[model samples]
Target: MPNPADRNAMLEARRTLKMAQSPHAYVRGNTAKFYEWLAASPVSRRVPTGPAIWICGDCHLGNLGPIANGQGSVEIQIRDLDQAVIGNPAHDLIRLGLSLATAARGSDLPGVVTMRMMEEMIDGYAAAIHDPTSGVPGVESDIVRSVERAALGRRWRHLAKERLDAVEPRIPLGKKFWELSAEEREALTTLFAEKHVGAMILSLQGKPKDREVRLVDAAYWMKGCSSLGLLRYAAIVALKTRKGRWSYALVDLKEATTPIAPAAPGADMPDDDAERVVAAARHLSPYLGSRMMPVRMLDRSLFIRELTPQDLKLEVDQFSHGEAVRAARHLAFVVGTAHARQMDPATRTEWLAILEADRRGTLDTPSWLWESIVSLSGSHEAGYLDHCRRYALAA
Candidate 1:
């Protein structure tokens, strides 16, 4: 159990942070309590048979998005792992389930209808992971909307040439975000910028020319509303050997915390984020964490892996009525898989039933209500952000 004092303090901090217009900022300090929660629960830590990758901790509708691939294929896949922990299959599901519930509250769709979608998604994942042969008809354990490799690789080159707002390296921001926190900037720049670039060149596979070697470049990027004030930097590591030829590596560092709920806020316990991911991956699904590299340095949690382009999802506002439901259905399976992955077989079965029940009740609702929820959420988000901004200026 977490200390009583710590829990109270976190709740108060969350209020302050929320008042500062930072709903997008992730701040889950003392999240270790979640691990403790899972342990005490009746969930099993056994891994199912399959290839696993590092599970995203905070996977939800908003977190899924597109990434460019080295091959130019714009694949869709899962992203975000602030609360990610190495544990069971379904840790992220809890977040997904609640998000769906909260999301539904804002729309005109009856709560029952949204619940049905959630149920379908959950059952889909159960069948996919447990009995692939059975062929459950849904999306779970799948990277939400990731694209293909060859295509992503092709898209990557094209994107590189164009000006990407955040994902692609097109802008020439020569280190202005650094002024915000000079101490953090110096510490990170010294670690990642110049030194890592030199090391990357030697890691090159074949020999080339020294004349071919190019110095790596570094720049600060400002994006992601939740992570707005947090630190972020990227470096272009191009490799060259004794012969004149070139290859490149992309490395980045960013704030790893999640947006704080109005009920809680503050700097997250630095090491907890990565630890949660590793522990959950180790316990719930080893395959997911296989290629995922987890490390923490300079009091920050970091995960290193190939930036996947296959992962993708459409923006929420972009979706129409039918499209939103489709999105809900897709998210359902992913979240279900996450929950079942963590809990014991019995618990999984029970959750499956409850979620199914939630789904069936929605069989008769009007779809317009669903759309209304999206609007409500947006309004609430705006209202909350405004409230927080006032305090930020005060502080």
Candidate 2:
């Protein structure tokens, strides 16, 4: 962790600088602002009441990407669940729509292209609601395909090189990793000494379940936009198998907080925030959820998961007209599948009808969705400019 005296200030500076880089970056970093706008706007009342199910409360383009399951199978799914909750599914659709629209604006795409992307997004989502078991649509953009291929070919070496900047069995203390306090190190050592924690690491790599695990190295990890100020650590562990081979795993421990995204009224949820995040992940993104284990450290709730080389977020900074529309369809399809699987046949049918009923004669997409995107986009753009001005003055 950073020096306790300067941690918050340093992290706030870094977060602001990152969010000021582009409009899409701003959208990704400002989840609280997004929900606040929805709460204060009349548009919130118009959004259809979706079935109460687990949602990727902060669903945005940057949050969806390729993830590997415990068995090493790769699929596109929601990768972040810090803000997840049993909430209205329509909130996710609107959040994702805002992300796509802001990204289109960042890429300098015309307004008409953004409108078409929204139409395709609704079409793709409705398709999944109609048939949850159907395969992903074949209209993926070249950028997405390239990312999928890269994710499939990645291995431990790639992850070590990219994240740690080397394949050594230690976390280098530099820009991304910092020396941990003695107390922090001792807590991590005690946490990893538990039998269940050792078993979890061994199971991920198919090693002998009874083998002992050693914490080779640990550091305060600097990662994520919204999670910059939280308790984040990267710990590398080693286990020797009966065959005299050694296995290694990179574990990510992140603090969990109360979600800014509102949960459905009277929703029954776990009181522990970490437990809520873990449950949400399992329901919305099994590949990610399967690897997660909630734990407590220094009296704070945190969740630890083994990081796979194949897990990567989508980076859609620039988009052509064709790529724009295709990406909207494919990404929305992934989100729809997450939401649709939790609903029964009748519930899904009812949700689809609700979505379809919102479309006007000429507009293929729902007017409410389109209007929400436009309103949120305008608000965020102005917010971004104001944020940049303040950041500049601070610097």
Candidate 3:
């Protein structure tokens, strides 16, 4: 039996309700369950365990987006690192394929379209791994174009309004932002005062190393699906400028928990959860990792980073047949680029060769990928319906 107190029951109930809404939602919110099923499936054995590289364990559509680097340039990359680990890159590929296939089903596209998407996905990934210096293939989807344009035009005022509910500097404690406890507030105050934390804040704005950092306001953040019950907080900090002006930065502090996704058998990774997340982020998402620092707060490990307005999630609520094909190729290239960076030249060549071989009678996609998505999609649909039935009964 599970310990009820280990998790917040009310929040778990809310998570269940969110998962029951649709198959895509279920896939996004139930990564742990996905890993459990993957372990028990025969397809897991057939997929070659490529080089042990840091991988985004939950490489779904929603988690891939535009992230602005410290230099103020934005590019599409993996945005979430909660489940990151040094593992077989194949897991990320399959997870991403599962996500895209589920979205196609939600869009009511025929099964043939998904097959094509998988083939295109492999093509995009292989292209990146083979030629590391090549630019990402252009995607002509309107959604992609619009998101890029919006990210480029974002500024501090835009982030203030979206996160703080206003253009002012203080975080409002209500609805999305709950009031922090006494202990949490004190921990946050001390955290910002630390030398390393102050350096991280200044690293983003290119401020002087001696500049003072102050915690202006903070709140218990009520966000994310799978991470709902975890300790998450948003802090507003001000960096004093030489001209006596104050610039504010929004910092996200999230507790690092043990990953449900299995790492490669002999993979060497940090034992500390916070350190593990930071290490993986540094390898896979330089834009986000460069601005992040791991710290201890209230005796628990946490990862803290400054959030920029240009950091936006790729939202694919609906997709046309053409859009679906283009998205799969483009997003797979993004994930592949992350993985390819950590691989040596020899390893990259070997991995690409393995992926290209054995295309299962003109399908032009690895047989394991096709089989895995078909199986996982069916399993997730059944699980989604079962979840809805239970939720309805509980209510």
Q: Tell me, by TM-score, which candidate is best.
A: 2
Candidate 2 residue 306 Cα shift, in angstroms, is: 0.3
Rank list by TM-score: 2, 3, 1
Off by over 4 Å in 1: 1-57, 65-77, 86-94, 97-116, 122-136, 139-154, 158-171, 174-215, 226-230, 241-244, 255-272, 278-292, 295-301, 305-313, 338-395
Give model 2's TM-score versus the native structure.
0.98
> Between which residue pairs do clashes occur in model 3?
none
Total residue pair clashes for candidate 2? 0
For model 2, residues 228-273, the per-residue Cα lDDT tens digits are: 5588899998888897777789999988998999999999989999
Which of candidates 2 and 3 reaches a greater TM-score? 2
How far off is residue 395 in model 3, in Å?
A: 1.6
Model 3 agreement with the true structure over 228-339: per-residue lDDT tens digits:
5578889999999999899999999999999988898888999989899888888998898898888998888999989999999998889999999998888888899999
Counted clashes in each candidate structure: 93, 0, 0
State every prediction's TM-score relative to the real structure: 0.54, 0.98, 0.96
Predicted candidate 1 versus true structure: per-residue lDDT over 258-367, tens digit per residue: 42211112323334555554454443333333324444556676543333233344434233334445556565444444434545556655544443443335342222
Deviation in Å, model 1, residue 326 alpha carbon: 2.9
RMSD of each: 10.0, 1.2, 2.6
Look at candidate 2 and give me any clashing residue pairs: none
Q: What is the lDDT of residue 275 in candidate 3?
A: 91
Global lDDT of each candidate: 0.42, 0.89, 0.87
* Best model per lDDT: 2
